[model samples]
Target: MSRTLVIGDIHGGLKALEQVLERAHVTTNDKLIFLGDFVDGWNDTPFVIDFLIDLDKTHNCVFIQGNHEEMLLRWLSEGHDNEEWRLHGGQSTVDVYGKIDADRVSAHINFLIKLNDYHLDDQNRLFVHAGFTNQKGVEYEYFKGMFCWDRTLWEAALSMDATLGRKDLFYPQRLALYEEIFIGHTPVTRIGYSVPVNRANVWNVDTGAAFKGRLTIMDVDTKEFWQSRPLPELYPDEKGRN
Candidate 1:
Protein backbone atom coordinates (compact mmCIF):
# COMPACT_ATOMS: atom_id res chain seq x y z
CA MET A 1 0.00 0.00 0.00
CA SER A 2 1.10 3.52 -0.69
CA ARG A 3 2.12 5.62 2.31
CA THR A 4 1.37 9.15 3.43
CA LEU A 5 4.35 11.20 4.66
CA VAL A 6 4.06 14.43 6.61
CA ILE A 7 7.05 16.79 6.69
CA GLY A 8 7.90 19.46 9.24
CA ASP A 9 8.90 23.11 9.06
CA ILE A 10 11.58 23.68 6.40
CA HIS A 11 12.70 27.24 7.20
CA GLY A 12 14.58 27.65 3.88
CA GLY A 13 16.95 24.76 4.51
CA LEU A 14 16.87 23.40 0.98
CA LYS A 15 19.62 20.84 1.47
CA ALA A 16 18.00 19.64 4.67
CA LEU A 17 14.67 19.28 2.93
CA GLU A 18 16.22 17.28 0.11
CA GLN A 19 18.07 15.08 2.57
CA VAL A 20 14.89 14.28 4.51
CA LEU A 21 13.01 13.41 1.33
CA GLU A 22 15.77 11.09 0.25
CA ARG A 23 15.87 9.50 3.68
CA ALA A 24 12.12 8.90 3.48
CA HIS A 25 12.53 7.41 -0.02
CA VAL A 26 9.62 9.49 -1.26
CA THR A 27 8.03 8.38 -4.50
CA THR A 28 5.40 9.75 -6.82
CA ASN A 29 3.03 7.01 -5.67
CA ASP A 30 3.09 8.27 -2.09
CA LYS A 31 1.25 11.30 -0.73
CA LEU A 32 3.34 14.07 0.83
CA ILE A 33 2.07 16.72 3.20
CA PHE A 34 4.28 19.67 4.13
CA LEU A 35 3.62 21.52 7.38
CA GLY A 36 4.92 24.75 5.93
CA ASP A 37 7.54 27.39 6.96
CA PHE A 38 9.23 26.83 3.60
CA VAL A 39 11.03 30.16 3.71
CA ASP A 40 12.88 32.40 6.17
CA GLY A 41 16.04 31.51 8.15
CA TRP A 42 18.46 30.02 5.68
CA ASN A 43 19.73 31.74 2.52
CA ASP A 44 18.02 29.55 -0.06
CA THR A 45 14.43 30.63 0.44
CA PRO A 46 13.77 31.10 -3.28
CA PHE A 47 15.34 27.77 -4.16
CA VAL A 48 13.24 26.01 -1.55
CA ILE A 49 10.07 27.37 -3.09
CA ASP A 50 11.22 26.37 -6.54
CA PHE A 51 12.04 22.86 -5.37
CA LEU A 52 8.53 22.42 -3.90
CA ILE A 53 6.94 23.74 -7.09
CA ASP A 54 8.86 21.19 -9.08
CA LEU A 55 8.05 18.40 -6.67
CA ASP A 56 4.35 19.19 -6.89
CA LYS A 57 4.41 18.52 -10.62
CA THR A 58 5.49 14.92 -10.07
CA HIS A 59 4.27 13.90 -6.64
CA ASN A 60 1.01 14.17 -4.71
CA CYS A 61 1.89 17.09 -2.42
CA VAL A 62 -0.09 19.27 -0.03
CA PHE A 63 1.33 22.56 1.25
CA ILE A 64 0.02 24.21 4.39
CA GLN A 65 0.61 27.85 5.20
CA GLY A 66 2.95 28.52 8.15
CA ASN A 67 3.42 31.72 10.14
CA HIS A 68 6.53 32.54 8.16
CA GLU A 69 4.67 32.16 4.93
CA GLU A 70 1.91 34.33 6.34
CA MET A 71 4.31 37.14 7.14
CA LEU A 72 6.06 36.85 3.79
CA LEU A 73 2.74 37.02 1.94
CA ARG A 74 1.65 40.03 3.93
CA TRP A 75 4.91 41.81 3.12
CA LEU A 76 4.60 40.99 -0.53
CA SER A 77 1.04 42.28 -0.80
CA GLU A 78 1.25 45.23 1.53
CA GLY A 79 4.51 46.74 0.19
CA HIS A 80 6.03 46.90 3.67
CA ASP A 81 8.13 44.53 5.73
CA ASN A 82 6.80 43.22 9.03
CA GLU A 83 9.33 44.07 11.75
CA GLU A 84 8.57 40.95 13.71
CA TRP A 85 8.99 38.82 10.63
CA ARG A 86 12.34 40.39 9.82
CA LEU A 87 13.52 39.85 13.36
CA HIS A 88 12.80 36.15 12.98
CA GLY A 89 14.81 35.19 9.88
CA GLY A 90 12.54 36.97 7.39
CA GLN A 91 15.43 39.21 6.43
CA SER A 92 17.35 36.23 5.12
CA THR A 93 14.52 35.49 2.71
CA VAL A 94 14.37 39.12 1.63
CA ASP A 95 18.13 39.28 1.21
CA VAL A 96 18.12 36.21 -1.05
CA TYR A 97 15.23 37.25 -3.30
CA GLY A 98 15.40 41.03 -3.07
CA LYS A 99 17.05 41.44 -6.45
CA ILE A 100 15.16 38.71 -8.33
CA ASP A 101 12.95 39.53 -11.29
CA ALA A 102 9.41 40.69 -10.78
CA ASP A 103 7.79 37.67 -12.43
CA ARG A 104 9.70 35.20 -10.32
CA VAL A 105 8.89 37.08 -7.13
CA SER A 106 5.27 37.15 -8.16
CA ALA A 107 5.27 33.41 -8.76
CA HIS A 108 6.63 32.77 -5.28
CA ILE A 109 4.04 35.10 -3.81
CA ASN A 110 1.27 33.31 -5.70
CA PHE A 111 2.41 29.95 -4.44
CA LEU A 112 2.56 31.11 -0.84
CA ILE A 113 -0.84 32.81 -1.09
CA LYS A 114 -2.52 29.60 -2.24
CA LEU A 115 -1.23 27.42 0.62
CA ASN A 116 -3.96 25.83 2.76
CA ASP A 117 -4.34 26.55 6.47
CA TYR A 118 -4.94 22.90 7.20
CA HIS A 119 -5.66 19.64 5.38
CA LEU A 120 -7.76 16.65 6.45
CA ASP A 121 -7.18 13.42 4.61
CA ASP A 122 -9.60 10.55 4.01
CA GLN A 123 -8.32 8.66 7.06
CA ASN A 124 -9.24 11.68 9.28
CA ARG A 125 -5.67 12.73 10.04
CA LEU A 126 -5.28 16.47 10.50
CA PHE A 127 -2.23 18.24 8.98
CA VAL A 128 -1.54 21.80 9.97
CA HIS A 129 1.46 24.13 10.33
CA ALA A 130 0.27 25.06 13.81
CA GLY A 131 -2.48 23.90 16.13
CA PHE A 132 -6.13 24.86 15.67
CA THR A 133 -8.59 26.21 18.26
CA ASN A 134 -11.76 24.27 17.44
CA GLN A 135 -11.93 20.51 17.86
CA LYS A 136 -14.84 20.18 15.46
CA GLY A 137 -13.21 21.86 12.45
CA VAL A 138 -11.24 25.05 11.92
CA GLU A 139 -13.03 28.12 10.59
CA TYR A 140 -10.03 28.70 8.30
CA GLU A 141 -11.64 31.42 6.22
CA TYR A 142 -12.27 33.77 9.13
CA PHE A 143 -9.49 32.80 11.53
CA LYS A 144 -6.80 31.64 9.14
CA GLY A 145 -4.03 33.14 11.27
CA MET A 146 -4.79 30.81 14.16
CA PHE A 147 -4.12 27.78 12.02
CA CYS A 148 -0.46 28.81 11.69
CA TRP A 149 0.03 30.87 14.85
CA ASP A 150 -1.67 29.10 17.73
CA ARG A 151 0.54 27.52 20.42
CA THR A 152 -2.10 27.01 23.09
CA LEU A 153 -3.39 23.88 21.41
CA TRP A 154 0.00 22.21 21.52
CA GLU A 155 0.51 23.48 25.06
CA ALA A 156 -2.78 21.87 26.06
CA ALA A 157 -1.72 18.59 24.55
CA LEU A 158 1.57 18.72 26.40
CA SER A 159 -0.04 19.61 29.71
CA MET A 160 -2.74 16.89 29.56
CA ASP A 161 -2.41 14.39 32.35
CA ALA A 162 -2.42 11.24 30.26
CA THR A 163 -2.17 9.22 33.50
CA LEU A 164 -5.83 9.90 34.01
CA GLY A 165 -7.68 6.80 32.75
CA ARG A 166 -10.65 8.80 31.59
CA LYS A 167 -9.05 11.26 29.17
CA ASP A 168 -12.53 12.51 28.35
CA LEU A 169 -12.71 14.15 31.74
CA PHE A 170 -10.09 16.66 30.64
CA TYR A 171 -10.58 18.34 27.25
CA PRO A 172 -11.80 15.08 25.75
CA GLN A 173 -13.24 16.68 22.65
CA ARG A 174 -10.11 18.67 21.84
CA LEU A 175 -7.85 16.11 20.21
CA ALA A 176 -10.48 13.36 19.97
CA LEU A 177 -11.86 14.92 16.82
CA TYR A 178 -9.17 13.32 14.63
CA GLU A 179 -7.31 10.05 14.49
CA GLU A 180 -3.98 11.92 14.54
CA ILE A 181 -2.93 15.53 14.54
CA PHE A 182 0.35 16.69 12.95
CA ILE A 183 1.83 20.13 13.57
CA GLY A 184 5.16 21.96 12.96
CA HIS A 185 5.31 25.53 14.31
CA THR A 186 6.70 24.59 17.73
CA PRO A 187 10.08 22.94 17.29
CA VAL A 188 10.79 19.78 19.22
CA THR A 189 14.30 21.05 19.89
CA ARG A 190 12.89 23.69 22.19
CA ILE A 191 11.91 20.90 24.57
CA GLY A 192 15.35 19.26 24.13
CA TYR A 193 14.25 16.52 21.74
CA SER A 194 16.12 16.32 18.46
CA VAL A 195 13.32 14.15 17.09
CA PRO A 196 9.60 14.54 16.69
CA VAL A 197 7.72 14.79 19.99
CA ASN A 198 4.44 13.04 20.61
CA ARG A 199 2.11 14.17 23.39
CA ALA A 200 -1.42 12.94 23.76
CA ASN A 201 -2.55 12.39 20.13
CA VAL A 202 -0.61 15.32 18.72
CA TRP A 203 2.67 14.81 16.86
CA ASN A 204 5.04 17.74 16.51
CA VAL A 205 7.36 16.96 13.60
CA ASP A 206 9.32 20.17 13.42
CA THR A 207 12.73 19.10 14.67
CA GLY A 208 14.04 22.64 14.35
CA ALA A 209 15.43 22.70 10.81
CA ALA A 210 16.37 26.36 11.25
CA PHE A 211 18.22 25.76 14.47
CA LYS A 212 20.74 23.12 15.50
CA GLY A 213 18.36 20.22 14.86
CA ARG A 214 17.46 18.31 11.73
CA LEU A 215 14.37 18.28 9.57
CA THR A 216 11.92 15.38 9.97
CA ILE A 217 9.39 13.39 7.98
CA MET A 218 6.98 10.88 9.50
CA ASP A 219 4.73 8.18 8.11
CA VAL A 220 1.15 8.91 9.04
CA ASP A 221 0.09 5.30 9.46
CA THR A 222 3.14 3.45 10.71
CA LYS A 223 4.56 6.39 12.67
CA GLU A 224 8.05 5.65 11.34
CA PHE A 225 10.24 8.70 10.78
CA TRP A 226 13.26 9.94 8.79
CA GLN A 227 15.52 12.92 9.41
CA SER A 228 18.18 15.02 7.72
CA ARG A 229 21.62 15.87 9.05
CA PRO A 230 21.95 18.72 11.53
CA LEU A 231 21.07 22.08 10.03
CA PRO A 232 24.53 23.59 10.63
CA GLU A 233 26.21 20.69 8.84
CA LEU A 234 23.84 21.06 5.90
CA TYR A 235 24.87 24.70 5.47
CA PRO A 236 28.41 25.02 6.66
CA ASP A 237 29.01 28.48 5.25
CA GLU A 238 26.09 30.44 6.64
CA LYS A 239 24.91 30.98 10.17
CA GLY A 240 21.18 30.43 9.80
CA ARG A 241 18.70 32.71 11.60
CA ASN A 242 20.47 32.12 14.91
Candidate 2:
Protein backbone atom coordinates (compact mmCIF):
# COMPACT_ATOMS: atom_id res chain seq x y z
CA MET A 1 0.00 0.00 0.00
CA SER A 2 1.13 3.52 -0.74
CA ARG A 3 2.07 5.62 2.31
CA THR A 4 2.09 9.27 3.29
CA LEU A 5 5.49 10.73 4.16
CA VAL A 6 5.63 13.94 6.19
CA ILE A 7 8.93 15.81 6.11
CA GLY A 8 10.30 18.43 8.44
CA ASP A 9 11.87 21.83 7.85
CA ILE A 10 14.52 21.45 5.17
CA HIS A 11 16.35 24.77 5.62
CA GLY A 12 18.43 24.23 2.47
CA GLY A 13 20.18 21.08 3.60
CA LEU A 14 19.84 19.48 0.17
CA LYS A 15 22.10 16.54 0.96
CA ALA A 16 20.19 15.81 4.15
CA LEU A 17 16.93 16.09 2.26
CA GLU A 18 18.20 13.69 -0.39
CA GLN A 19 19.46 11.20 2.16
CA VAL A 20 16.20 11.20 4.11
CA LEU A 21 14.20 10.65 0.93
CA GLU A 22 16.45 7.79 -0.03
CA ARG A 23 16.27 6.24 3.43
CA ALA A 24 12.52 6.56 3.45
CA HIS A 25 12.35 4.83 0.06
CA VAL A 26 9.82 7.39 -1.11
CA THR A 27 8.15 6.60 -4.39
CA THR A 28 5.84 8.40 -6.77
CA ASN A 29 2.94 6.51 -5.30
CA ASP A 30 3.64 7.82 -1.84
CA LYS A 31 2.20 11.18 -0.88
CA LEU A 32 4.88 13.61 0.27
CA ILE A 33 3.91 16.45 2.54
CA PHE A 34 6.71 18.90 3.29
CA LEU A 35 6.38 21.01 6.44
CA GLY A 36 8.34 23.88 4.83
CA ASP A 37 11.26 26.18 5.71
CA PHE A 38 12.66 24.75 2.47
CA VAL A 39 15.10 27.60 1.96
CA ASP A 40 17.66 29.49 4.05
CA GLY A 41 20.39 28.37 6.48
CA TRP A 42 22.48 26.04 4.27
CA ASN A 43 23.98 27.21 0.96
CA ASP A 44 21.85 25.07 -1.34
CA THR A 45 18.61 27.02 -1.22
CA PRO A 46 18.24 27.31 -4.98
CA PHE A 47 19.20 23.71 -5.48
CA VAL A 48 16.68 22.65 -2.86
CA ILE A 49 13.89 24.44 -4.71
CA ASP A 50 14.98 22.91 -8.01
CA PHE A 51 14.98 19.44 -6.50
CA LEU A 52 11.53 19.87 -4.95
CA ILE A 53 10.17 21.18 -8.23
CA ASP A 54 11.46 18.08 -9.92
CA LEU A 55 10.16 15.80 -7.19
CA ASP A 56 6.69 17.28 -7.44
CA LYS A 57 6.53 16.26 -11.08
CA THR A 58 6.76 12.61 -10.09
CA HIS A 59 5.17 12.46 -6.68
CA ASN A 60 2.12 13.80 -4.89
CA CYS A 61 3.83 16.66 -3.09
CA VAL A 62 2.19 19.19 -0.79
CA PHE A 63 4.30 22.21 0.07
CA ILE A 64 3.40 24.33 3.08
CA GLN A 65 4.52 27.93 3.49
CA GLY A 66 7.06 28.57 6.26
CA ASN A 67 7.97 31.79 8.06
CA HIS A 68 11.32 31.86 6.31
CA GLU A 69 9.60 31.58 2.96
CA GLU A 70 7.24 34.34 4.01
CA MET A 71 10.17 36.57 4.90
CA LEU A 72 11.88 35.82 1.61
CA LEU A 73 8.69 36.53 -0.31
CA ARG A 74 8.25 39.84 1.49
CA TRP A 75 11.82 40.77 0.69
CA LEU A 76 11.37 39.89 -2.95
CA SER A 77 8.00 41.54 -3.51
CA GLU A 78 8.41 44.57 -1.26
CA GLY A 79 12.04 45.22 -2.27
CA HIS A 80 12.88 45.87 1.35
CA ASP A 81 14.94 43.16 2.96
CA ASN A 82 14.18 42.23 6.54
CA GLU A 83 17.33 42.43 8.63
CA GLU A 84 15.97 39.83 11.00
CA TRP A 85 15.45 37.34 8.19
CA ARG A 86 18.95 38.00 6.89
CA LEU A 87 20.43 37.42 10.32
CA HIS A 88 18.58 34.14 10.69
CA GLY A 89 19.86 32.24 7.61
CA GLY A 90 18.18 34.26 4.81
CA GLN A 91 21.59 35.71 3.96
CA SER A 92 22.81 32.27 2.95
CA THR A 93 19.86 31.95 0.57
CA VAL A 94 20.70 35.30 -0.99
CA ASP A 95 24.34 34.30 -1.15
CA VAL A 96 23.44 31.13 -3.02
CA TYR A 97 22.14 33.17 -5.92
CA GLY A 98 24.75 35.90 -5.74
CA LYS A 99 23.88 37.43 -9.07
CA ILE A 100 20.20 36.71 -9.19
CA ASP A 101 18.65 35.51 -12.42
CA ALA A 102 15.51 37.55 -12.71
CA ASP A 103 13.59 34.85 -14.52
CA ARG A 104 14.70 32.07 -12.19
CA VAL A 105 14.18 34.20 -9.13
CA SER A 106 10.74 35.11 -10.41
CA ALA A 107 9.89 31.45 -10.84
CA HIS A 108 11.06 30.70 -7.30
CA ILE A 109 9.11 33.65 -5.99
CA ASN A 110 5.99 32.38 -7.70
CA PHE A 111 6.49 28.97 -6.16
CA LEU A 112 6.95 30.43 -2.72
CA ILE A 113 3.95 32.70 -3.16
CA LYS A 114 1.73 29.78 -4.08
CA LEU A 115 2.60 27.60 -1.12
CA ASN A 116 -0.34 26.53 1.04
CA ASP A 117 -0.52 27.43 4.70
CA TYR A 118 -1.58 23.93 5.68
CA HIS A 119 -2.82 20.63 4.28
CA LEU A 120 -5.39 18.20 5.65
CA ASP A 121 -5.25 14.68 4.33
CA ASP A 122 -8.05 12.14 3.97
CA GLN A 123 -7.15 10.68 7.34
CA ASN A 124 -7.75 14.09 8.97
CA ARG A 125 -4.01 14.55 9.43
CA LEU A 126 -3.21 18.26 9.54
CA PHE A 127 0.19 19.20 8.14
CA VAL A 128 1.53 22.68 8.71
CA HIS A 129 4.82 24.54 8.89
CA ALA A 130 3.87 25.75 12.35
CA GLY A 131 0.92 25.57 14.69
CA PHE A 132 -2.50 27.19 14.46
CA THR A 133 -4.41 29.20 17.07
CA ASN A 134 -7.83 27.84 16.13
CA GLN A 135 -9.68 25.90 18.77
CA LYS A 136 -11.67 24.14 16.08
CA GLY A 137 -10.27 22.89 12.77
CA VAL A 138 -7.48 24.92 11.19
CA GLU A 139 -8.58 28.24 9.71
CA TYR A 140 -5.52 28.60 7.52
CA GLU A 141 -7.11 31.19 5.25
CA TYR A 142 -7.74 33.53 8.15
CA PHE A 143 -4.51 32.91 10.06
CA LYS A 144 -2.01 32.35 7.29
CA GLY A 145 0.84 33.96 9.20
CA MET A 146 0.12 32.10 12.39
CA PHE A 147 -0.02 28.84 10.45
CA CYS A 148 3.69 29.23 9.86
CA TRP A 149 4.72 31.34 12.84
CA ASP A 150 2.76 30.37 15.94
CA ARG A 151 4.44 28.46 18.76
CA THR A 152 1.56 28.54 21.20
CA LEU A 153 0.08 25.32 19.88
CA TRP A 154 3.32 23.43 20.28
CA GLU A 155 3.95 25.13 23.59
CA ALA A 156 0.51 24.06 24.78
CA ALA A 157 1.22 20.50 23.67
CA LEU A 158 4.55 20.52 25.46
CA SER A 159 2.96 21.80 28.64
CA MET A 160 0.57 18.89 28.78
CA ASP A 161 2.08 15.92 30.58
CA ALA A 162 0.83 12.92 28.66
CA THR A 163 2.28 10.76 31.38
CA LEU A 164 -0.62 11.97 33.51
CA GLY A 165 -3.51 9.54 33.70
CA ARG A 166 -6.26 11.81 32.38
CA LYS A 167 -5.41 12.62 28.74
CA ASP A 168 -8.71 14.30 27.87
CA LEU A 169 -8.34 16.66 30.82
CA PHE A 170 -4.77 17.62 29.99
CA TYR A 171 -4.79 17.62 26.18
CA PRO A 172 -6.25 20.71 24.60
CA GLN A 173 -9.49 20.37 22.67
CA ARG A 174 -7.98 22.25 19.75
CA LEU A 175 -5.64 19.35 19.10
CA ALA A 176 -8.53 16.93 19.03
CA LEU A 177 -9.88 18.66 15.92
CA TYR A 178 -7.54 16.55 13.87
CA GLU A 179 -6.71 12.90 14.19
CA GLU A 180 -3.04 13.89 14.03
CA ILE A 181 -1.23 17.18 13.57
CA PHE A 182 2.25 17.31 12.07
CA ILE A 183 4.33 20.45 12.21
CA GLY A 184 7.78 21.88 11.60
CA HIS A 185 9.31 25.31 12.52
CA THR A 186 9.99 24.39 16.14
CA PRO A 187 12.77 21.81 15.83
CA VAL A 188 12.81 18.80 18.06
CA THR A 189 16.46 19.49 18.85
CA ARG A 190 15.33 22.29 21.17
CA ILE A 191 13.90 19.49 23.31
CA GLY A 192 17.17 17.56 22.91
CA TYR A 193 15.78 14.97 20.55
CA SER A 194 17.34 14.31 17.15
CA VAL A 195 14.19 12.46 16.19
CA PRO A 196 10.52 13.44 15.83
CA VAL A 197 8.86 14.36 19.12
CA ASN A 198 5.30 13.32 19.84
CA ARG A 199 2.98 14.94 22.36
CA ALA A 200 -0.62 13.80 22.41
CA ASN A 201 -1.73 13.92 18.75
CA VAL A 202 0.76 16.62 17.73
CA TRP A 203 4.07 15.59 16.19
CA ASN A 204 7.00 17.96 15.74
CA VAL A 205 9.30 16.59 13.07
CA ASP A 206 11.78 19.38 12.53
CA THR A 207 15.05 18.00 13.90
CA GLY A 208 16.82 21.34 13.34
CA ALA A 209 18.40 20.81 9.94
CA ALA A 210 19.22 24.53 10.00
CA PHE A 211 21.29 24.02 13.13
CA LYS A 212 22.95 20.94 14.64
CA GLY A 213 20.37 18.25 13.99
CA ARG A 214 19.35 16.31 10.89
CA LEU A 215 16.38 16.48 8.50
CA THR A 216 13.64 13.98 9.18
CA ILE A 217 10.85 12.24 7.25
CA MET A 218 8.20 10.09 8.85
CA ASP A 219 5.59 7.68 7.54
CA VAL A 220 2.37 9.18 8.83
CA ASP A 221 0.55 5.90 9.00
CA THR A 222 3.31 3.77 10.46
CA LYS A 223 5.16 6.46 12.45
CA GLU A 224 8.40 5.02 11.04
CA PHE A 225 11.01 7.73 10.58
CA TRP A 226 14.19 8.33 8.59
CA GLN A 227 16.86 10.92 9.37
CA SER A 228 19.91 12.26 7.61
CA ARG A 229 23.36 12.63 9.09
CA PRO A 230 23.79 15.75 11.18
CA LEU A 231 23.91 19.06 9.28
CA PRO A 232 27.56 19.58 10.28
CA GLU A 233 28.40 16.13 8.91
CA LEU A 234 26.53 16.82 5.68
CA TYR A 235 28.14 20.21 5.06
CA PRO A 236 31.51 20.14 6.80
CA ASP A 237 32.86 23.40 5.41
CA GLU A 238 29.93 25.61 6.43
CA LYS A 239 28.09 26.59 9.57
CA GLY A 240 24.40 26.26 8.66
CA ARG A 241 22.85 28.41 11.36
CA ASN A 242 24.79 27.56 14.49
Estimate every model's Cα lDDT from 0 to 1.
0.87, 0.88
Q: Which stretches of candidate 1 lie over 4 Å from their true place?
A: 139-142, 164-167
By summed lDDT, the worst window of 10 consecutive residues in model 1 runs over: 163-172
Across 6-66, the per-residue lDDT of candidate 1 in tens digits comes to: 9999999999999989988888899999999989999989899999988999999999999
Off by over 4 Å in 2: 140-142, 163-170
lDDT of 2 by residue, 1-242 (tens): 79999999999999999999999988888999999999999999988988988898889999999999898888777776888888899999878777668887888888888899899888788998888886766863466678989999899889887774334665687787788899999988888888999987889999999999999999998999999999999899998885
TM-score of 2: 0.95
How many pairs collide in each candidate, listed in order?
0, 0
Model 1 score (lDDT): 0.87
